[model samples]
Target chain A: MPNTDSILRFEKVTVAFGGDPAIEDVSFEIRAGESRVILGAAGSGKTVILKTSVGLLRPDSGRVFLFGQDITEMKEQDQFDLRARVGMLFQESALFDSLNIEENVAYPLLNQKAVNCPEDQVHARVEEALTFVELGHTLEKFPSELSGGMRRRVGIARANVTEPAMVIYDSPTAGLDPITANNIMALIVKERDVRHATTVMVTQRFQDGAIMARYKYDRATETLVAATPGDASIAGLKFLVMKQGRLVFEGTLAEMEQSKDPYISKFVLRN
Target chain B: MLDFLKSPVLAVQEFVFLTARTIRNLPVRPHYWRDILMQMDIIGVGSLPIVLLVGFFSGIVMALQMSRALQTYGAVSQTGPIVAITLVREMGPVLTSVVAAGRNAAGIASELGSMKVTEQIDAMRALGTDPIQKLVKPRLIATCVMLPCLTAIADFVGLLGGYFIGISLLNLTSAEYWTGAYRALEYDDVAQGLLKPFIYAIVISMVGCFYGLNTRGGTQGVGLATTQAVVSSIVWIFALNAIITKIFVSF
Candidate 1:
């Protein structure tokens, strides 16, 4: 049975570049307010899936449904309206180098017609978003002026500024150091908990997924606390393991850990 | 073999599609007026000094060369008409576009190629803005509008250079030079001069955008795209100049 609450659905989608399939026959459904951590090695099509979900890359075959509308054959202009409800952080943070942090964060608000954030309120919203990422003081700075971790934080602020219904992070901590990577993960957790936005994170690090599964953000304490057993938020969390353009595992953390398959086991045992 | 020809053929198809889409979007809603103004300031105002310098030098050289040829035919006084005709018909538009193609095309390619390799282009798409509408159209409009304006300036500057040379070196009066130069220009010559740059602007902006958008690999790819943009824009500028000039000549 199809979950009518699904925020994003990829039905037997195959995406290719230059006659080479980047992702093949992949199917997944992300429901509203649920979190999905997609784990894979480089070139496993994790990023491709995220891009296709947002209609950045159209699949060669199969259909993609976002917010109950089929986007597979939607015109580019129509996709822009649909995409306004979704936010994405690219692997490199992908901040517009030409714009300062304030403008970068305010991009969707100013550009997304569906967002329709009025001109007068744009500054306040940008400041609030930057404050959410703890980078309020860096508004005047450009992406090139910031450190790698700072840029990623700015990217996060930009992605969430629209208060999107769903947020996708593509390897938000791909090249960061351990401490910084954990800090980013904590922010992701905080965002997911606070906004209750549907979260889809793609990462190569098992620890990133582990962190998502094991912890929940406590608003009062403003810190991550271990979820009590069978907590609904934690229970709603799921894992997806991809290998060479194919989804090999999709289940809870425990189910993924208990898998007998060598590839799935490798991901679980790595950390 | 057909396999070898596939890449270039596909590239041509993509270029045509990109151009068509850009033209189609010209009247579309949500027009990025701010972006268009910014690009105009960059591509048009930024290239003014170089265009002026090139135009001046080209005129001086033409006057100097034509003086010697006219001396043999006892037509040394005809230097102004010759220089004016050449500048308006050929040298002014060609030199200005070549300059713009070198300056703006390379800049556009590197700027956009960097954005592509870093996934900012993808990010733009995901952020609910069409990269083509936001990025490419502004450039296309700016270049198309500005290139001809720049060429007109270059043409006037080139005439000034020729006038200076005619008075000092060729021993002609200002009246003699200005009168000949002014009378030499016709509506047809001005039309051709302006028309050529407008066409070259399309080639320069579109070729740069096409290569930039398709860039891959990384930083190295940006450098490659910049080079390709300059080379291709200049090549197309010359090829197009010949075709346009031939049509004008036949008319």
Candidate 2:
């Protein structure tokens, strides 16, 4: 389905590593204030898509537009200036080993030209961001001393401290226990609910599809479709499933459930 | 072994390509340059005292050994000239390069490699910051400037060490050793030794950063790259020193 209200749009974006396809000609739009999830199994190029959006990897072809500007072709200085609006929670959390939690959270903010906050105010804001992740007590701790969940929380805090309009989360639940993953997912959804960010999440977790109402307005059909829950189509959601870089299932989530296709049935079972 | 060579070559090619990409993506805004200068001081200045101490001791020992061997032939007077020539033309540059490979190269490699492994380098790129300009260029610039200066200091101090050893251990007068030393060192020897560290610094900084930027596998991969950067940089320093000496001193 075509989209009109996309704050972020990828037009035929393709990324290849060593001439082998990692993600190919995949395109999607994330509207402003929308919480969209890219769901796929292992080795399904999910993280690749997230990284490309944040300009970590350049596409071999096609353009990435943010708010009607071609960000892919923008100069580095321009991109750095533009990045105040976009933040990423890396898969590994990517906090500096030398930096304490406060310094890590305030990193992006300190780099900003507009932030006039003093050191104490910066500390306060870092504390505030950490509190959002329920990490207020760990302010003085170094990144090396933090546990994996704590590290992810720190990453999220750092990514959002600048109050970015767009936030990208790459595998926010990987390598965590069920409860912790659920908690992280809930925090992500809560941010989407309370903040004005266009949340772009890439996850393999089967439960995330059901945890929130991720709706997309299909311009061509002029219909509001949603992502299904319980790792299956909830009621009526417009889903376009891709496998091996080709769109396989493009229909309402209910239609996918009702289909007799063994692949769909097997996918449902596997999830 | 075949896979090993193939992979490094592929990795080097990728590094060059990525470096080119970074060059094109060079940021116009200046980052916090004070941090870069401090990193240089850490890489170059922090290593200076050790390099100088090593240089002086090596020269003094060499002079003592040579004077003992030459005394039987009544050629003990030649000790100052030999010590001065060797220190200025060979030992000073070579030793400083070795120290730099250990100090600066390892430091640059580990910093960038850890950044790579942890995804901070990728984060920089994601935020439209060029790692080469932001991280590598300052290091390379700092190394190129500092290594030669260290070499010069080493040569001067090394000659002084030889002078001190000659007077104390060789039963040679200070006047005699200074006279012989002054006679043997042409500006040619000083220039030759002085030139080697420039290339040495460049090689160490570039190879260190290239290996780091190519880091894969995770923490283990970054650790291995850091070790390899130091070792390979040391080997290159000595080999290049020999090659340059042979070229210039062949006459």
Candidate 3:
């Protein structure tokens, strides 16, 4: 299932700002039900990958294929039709501070014509997503009222409210404490397991301990090995390292650890 | 100068395409009705007091000044036709547009521009939603529709203002003034005035929404967008008003 037909396919995708390439000739593929994390520095075009795939920014060159469809040439309405298949969370929560939590979750649902959903059902889903993120009781609260960690949770809730097949997260753990970041990482893992969603994650965290700690292995009943400790244990989690918008490495977590890739080594060993 | 002319033409074409895209997108975007209603509230209902106040005073002042000036030549009765003609043809339409450009244009541009700064527009696009259709069309539709209603309101209020001054100050009998006003007003004059604002409506709403959709650079960008929306709209309104007035008056 991981490699049959890529859920998302990028072939020679390139993005530039002001005629200078931020990333160039980047290509990668993620299949259905697989979770991938892109590791890179600040200007490394990690978010650009998700932004281009979702049509927030168009690529200067190359193709973006989702579910085997070329999304680059699709009309906005078609893109919108495709939107239900993909959800993205900005590095910041990106909640409408003007709207409170419930309305923020309901924002996307309100944009359709036949939101003939019962208020109770919609309300219930709002609460459910909020509860999933542990922000259930703050439905009327504004984004301004939420803490940084809480806002990230709310952002995750809103992105998942549509039950999208794929969720793109930009630095979900960037500004939080170690404990809070772990909670968000745990939620990211939980969401994939529960929804069986394909996720693309961008993070700078790459320590072996942190990498192993981030996931709980469902390796045929061997969830974790007491002999080894790490910050990531994401089951079936695929990792990609990008440099200046180009693909630097692609492999499993263990493979990344073993490869003598200097960029990966430099990123992984950083304090 | 060459660069300036080139950009304006390119900008106009860009606006035209975006406008079409926005209109074409109306059926897909949700919250359109809400944005439309909010625009109506801002453009039509919110501006009522000022419009009424201006219309009334302008009407009264027109009657007074016209009557006095005409009376010096023993043609005071001509005030009726003169005030009626000016109100129906120019003041009612142009003033209404100017007011709209100041108020609703600023509001639409800033609302959109802030959304841009915050990535709410990006969020919409990511959701496969068209920003113009989701954000621009409703406001544009609301503007064109609301302007006529506002103009009509201005007409009624200005006439009443004329009535107040004419009867109380000029000592013109109510019957004589009303009869003369009705006699002087023509179908084409009123029709032409109502029609002129539609273009201004386009200028106001479209320009405002355009600035918003293209907003970047955070808070300063939004503020600049708001200012640009109002300034561009007012300029366009006056320019179009001049062209329309020439066509109407010649008729």
Candidate 4:
């Protein structure tokens, strides 16, 4: 179904690397204040689609529109301005090794000129962001000193430091133990609830995708609380399942669980 | 075989584009002054010991070798002039740049290459920071500013080393050595010494950044980039040396 109210849209986008296709004719649209979880097996080009949405990778054919503007051919300076509204969490957590966590979180605030405020304000914002991730005590620690889970949290903090309208998470929990993966997902849900920010998350783990679909952060108790069964808020979240660089299934997690397609059912069983 | 022929042309194209892009970013807003200072400390201050040691030894060796040859012609007093002119015009800048190419170029390549592999560079872009301006421009400025300073240090220490060698090893009088050395050095020779390394500095830094930013494969790719950065930088250093020397001499 075509989404005319898309805050992010990809129309017939095809991306290739060195003559081999990574994502082919992929089309998807994400509305503002909505959360999307893209699930696929390894080598399924989920990350490629996420990158294209953020303008890190340009589509070989067709157009990518961010906030109704075609970024495929946007001027670089304009692109930078456009990118300021979007935040991306890389699969590897991509924190600058040279910078400690405080500097890393403060990077976006410092660079985006419109946010030029006093140094103390920047520091307070950085501290607030780190606190949001529950890693506030690790502010002075470099990325090398953090565990994989801690690094991912710092990546989350840095990504949302500017309170961007759209956030892209590319396999945020790919290589971690299940417990750590759940912890990261909870933080992601917490941020989504608190900021009401639009999110596009790519993950290979079906359980993790389901967890995001089924959870909410309750600010009253300050905890990631599971949504009541059959809740309407859960309906705002969507899922896209990819196989061989094409979207095979797109719907709610309930639809995914009841999907009659053999491939989708197999993923349901395995995950 | 097909790839072999196309590779160098493609590499040159990449280098040219990177050079132009980095220069274009230099005058733009959002200058990374702190990064530039950090690079200066790394490239200039860090490479000092090696540059000084090489410069001093090259001068002493040249004086010792040239003195014997001069004695054969009954022109032993000319040792200081020959050593000074060679060190000032040829040996000092070239040797220091070669040392820098080996140490600093490889360091820059590996550092940037690792950042590329780890996706920190891409993260920079996603965060609205231009990697060329934030990463490459500061490095280019630092290297271009620092290499000449290192060369000047090398040249001065080299002359002092020659003085010591002339007076102590060759048994030449201090007056004869100092007089000949000062007389042989022309303004053009000093200008050539400083000018050549400035050009070489651009070449080395750009080549390093090009290969570094273009790195792929992973850790293995970073290693390959490091080797390529040093080898290519050294090659360009020699090539530019000959070309710049020709241009200066012709003028």
DockQ scores of the candidates: 0.92, 0.46, 0.50, 0.84
Interface RMSD, candidates in the order listed:
0.6, 2.2, 1.8, 0.9
Q: Rank the candidates by DockQ, best first.
A: 1, 4, 3, 2
- Per-residue CA lDDT of model 4 for B24-117, tens digit only, reads 8889988899999999999999999999999999998898898878889998889889988999899999999999999889999999999999
Off by over 4 Å in 3: A1-4, A109-120, A175-179, A205-213, A217-235, A254-264, B1-6, B25-31
Fnat, model by model in order, equals: 0.93, 0.50, 0.53, 0.85
> Which predicted model would earn the best lDDT?
1
Clashes of each: 0, 0, 19, 0
Instruction: Sort candidate 3 into its docking category.
Output: medium
Q: Write the per-residue lDDT of candidate 3 for residues B46-127, one digit (tens) a residue.
A: 9888888888888988888888888899876666677888888889888888888898889888988888887777877775
Point out where model 4 deviates above 4 Å. A1-5, A229-232, B1-3
Predictions in order: lDDT? 0.93, 0.75, 0.79, 0.89
lDDT of 1: 0.93
User: What would the per-residue lDDT of candidate 2 be over residues B61-115, giving only the tens digit for each residue?
Assistant: 8888888889989999888899888887888888888888887778888888889
Error of 4 at B218 (Å): 1.3
Q: After superposition, how far is residue B191 of candidate 1 from its true place, in Å?
A: 0.7
Docking class of 4: high
**lDDT (0-100) at residue B180 of candidate 3?**
85
Residue A205's lDDT in candidate 4: 86
